[model samples]
Target: MRADPKGVLTGDHYLDGDQACAEGALAAGCRFFAGYPITPSTEIAERFAERIPEAAGVFVQMEDELASMAAVLGAAWGGKKAMTVTSGPGFSLMMENIGLGVMMEVPCVVANVQRGGPSTGLPTLPGQADMMQARWGSHGDYEIIALSPNSPQECFDLVIEAFNLSEQYRVPVMFMMDECVGHLTEKVSIPRPESIEIVDRKWYRGRKENYLPYAVNGDLVPAMVKAGDGYRFHATGLTHDERGYPSTTWQTQEKCVHRLVNKIRQNAENIIKVEKDNVDDADVLVVSYGISSRVAVPAIQQARQQGIRVGHLRLITVWPFPEKMIRELAGRVKAFVMPEINYGQMVFEVERCAAGKAETYLVPHGGGWVHDPKNILQVIEAAAA
Candidate 1:
């Protein structure tokens, strides 16, 4: 991590949401950005390309999203913090390589500014359809960190956190952006250096002979060494053992899989994040995340005005859903209402976390429009009545 002169730097400039994302990556110590330009998300690449050179970093426009993702992985392996940005169609092309990153345990960031999809359903429109796909699209049992930003300022802040978590845990973190966030214009404050805390990838300081690429240390996160730092370690998609060589033995594979999954799963308590409101004493709970949470907030307020015992939980990290927090609410609240831009994605998680302790309902709709919280208030009212 590069150290800047102390004190926060505030800039007052008119910029688009995509520009904020790129700027966020740079502020977070990202030195490499590779991607193909796609609508609604293209501005991110364009902005990064122009800004990276000023930071003495490299920005390359690849031929396709596949190459873009591959290039980022390659850059990360070379010890440079790297990232790529894409929309729905481009995300489709990057999935296979995403799985490769997961298997190899690469540390990088991928910003998906989702437009309507299922083969380019709507290029300029907004949708949250990728929530399910973000967790399962890579085709494996590995864990991923996904952050959904409801505003441009969050776009800037969360991208920094994404890289920090990615390097900290050695995983591919996803910045989940919908059309609203990707297109929204808002003032974002760029904090001073003292306000930003950057985490560098842990490097092994032990003797060369003692280094094992896949060996389990106490934290389960093995220290990483660059490819040419005399580490001489192998990395591949196939299951591998401590020495980084492919292992066909079921025992080794089982251990490897368990560690890979547990490294993130076990740390979920640290990973889960949420925004709660008036939840200390409530009869009904409203669960929502991303831009949809913006709508639900007002609904929660209106319900409170009517003397309905309503509360809310706004999820910040969607992947490792805040199960524990939801469970606490389930025990106290009478019902849970989930509103989202998609038909239903996070609702299932809420249901699972509730564990039959409370009734869970889905208020679902999509197509670039924000969910109406009135539907949620009604749910709270009916459940209370």
Candidate 2:
């Protein structure tokens, strides 16, 4: 579907990541936004609140982050393509409902502009430390789609992809942008309304008398029906069956859980996205994502100048983690060096995927800022040695 011109901020302009994200959501047909302002990420909410009126959208400033997340899910099921924005503290508050959204198979976007933190860590600074939290903060077994944007341009482009992915899979998509990206200004060219491709809601079209809320139709995802849409269906936070009815029986649990996990697992290839450079003949691969991936470019160039066979793999989609690519590269490379602005989150995934076929190393940083190219180079040099 083409975007509606009313929401498309057409033409090129200098935009920070936060503003670009807001514009991207509007351009993608987001008709509702619920958010609580927080540093580094607050601009996203502010932009939406200011522009939504003109775009024929609803922007709500919820009392709290908890309410904000709950509202995002409600808005989604209410037939509005919805989203919410926040930083570390707010992102933490949204975890439980994030789990709820997963269980209910709600299609929404949660944009977390990360800051340094265990709690309210560095409100005004950058952090990639929340990468693990995005994966496991919401207790329970489920998979999510997460995207990392390294620039303001991507901040605009990836949100559209995020929303499209959410609707495509009937799941919540995470837009993970660190503080640096959110605050950094760069050029962003928004295409014309006719040029944008949008994925609309996968609405149920079955006869109302025989509707099954969670019934599978060839694909793992069941089509959805909006509230007050003259269709009878049920939605809940509890484990449910095809009819959206709760059943404590082991059989019901197995069916319910398997579908949630398998829907993503079965379609992993289509969801996984990565950018690679010089990996074919490289002896060491530098694996990074978000801002850290951009920071690694200089270190990679330095290594190449020093006659080292070092390659770069930037993860565009963080969740569903590029397991297959890592596994394949492990068999070819001498080692994989991962640099993330945290003690270590994704490095563990690389280690698991590498499975001892090759060595895996983590270049950890404790947030507030990005890693120095020297640090990454040191690790690459050691790995190359």
Candidate 3:
């Protein structure tokens, strides 16, 4: 229960992934959170409410997911590290504002502790179905950084990385945790404040007269300023120029949107992360993320024991979707096997990256549960064959 002056818990303790996510956000200098209560994801908002005050932070239980996202965007412009949590339907409700956050280039975090379904599928159970939604949920063209955590420890560690990426790229970073990871309790070691690395938003520090909200240098990311800092800047969802004025021309859209997409795309190599085991020389590569990644381990081991040369590739950074690594591996591996809670989401990305160079197999689950290791192993065997 002890925390440093900045409210970072500085010791090891038993915590669920949701709770660890809250602590990680605080440690990463997130001083504001606005979220509505939703199943599986509510514990994150609850933990943040209890702990944020100690960190000299603010927490708001917004009327719904839409306002929650709006408040987070506002808080970020007000010069606070801000975030929100949601699940399933709540996640769908927040998509419009999530797009607004992207168009405005607001630096904030949105955590979707995914549950099952297109609607109210499974409130109490886990699903990794939101993989595509987190990327393409919002309207129009834009890029985002998303991280998938396979364990409670990763929930703590990766959420901090999520915030750092959001700040560094001046974009909304999505922390994609499933119900299994969000509710699973495990030992999470909270590092000291000194040891925790935090990235602050790149603020506009020049003379107020020279401020242009959407202006950028070579990095494609523009500097941000606090809303009340006497900087006259306008932000909107419509296409805008460097001055932040709404412009409907194709040329303006090209300039504005291209940078929005390229800021992450061009720098994706640095932002993407994956955990690899025996990938260099393997006949079959098993690719998974979140809870499915952990569940696939046993199947991979079993396959190895049965004389199958299997490699495990666990995605840590799901979005900016590790195309280069997958492409390279596709050239070497004989086949690829992907297991996810959804019918088939990220597996399509794997298939695209594999580009028919290697055969791809999917182990799909409807929801409410994880794939049986035996089922996964069978697929591994098939892919190897």
Clashes of 1: 1
Candidate 2 lDDT by residue in tens digits, 211-285: 898999778899999898898788998888888988778898888888888898889899988998998999999
What local lDDT score does residue 139 receive in model 1, on the 0 to 100 scale?
81
RMSD of each: 1.9, 0.8, 1.8
The 10-residue segment with the lowest total lDDT in model 2: 246-255
Tens-place lDDT digits, model 3, residues 177-279: 9999999999999888877777777888899999988888889999999988789999999999989999999999999889999999999999989999999
TM-score of 3: 0.98
Runs in model 3 with CA error above 4 Å? 1-5
| Ordering by TM-score | 2, 3, 1
Give the Cα-based TM-score of candidate 1 against the true structure. Answer: 0.95
lDDT of candidate 1 vs native? 0.84
| Clashing pairs for predicted structure model 3, backbone only | none
Q: Give me the overall lDDT of model 2.
A: 0.93
Better of 1 and 3 by TM-score: 3
lDDT of each: 0.84, 0.93, 0.92
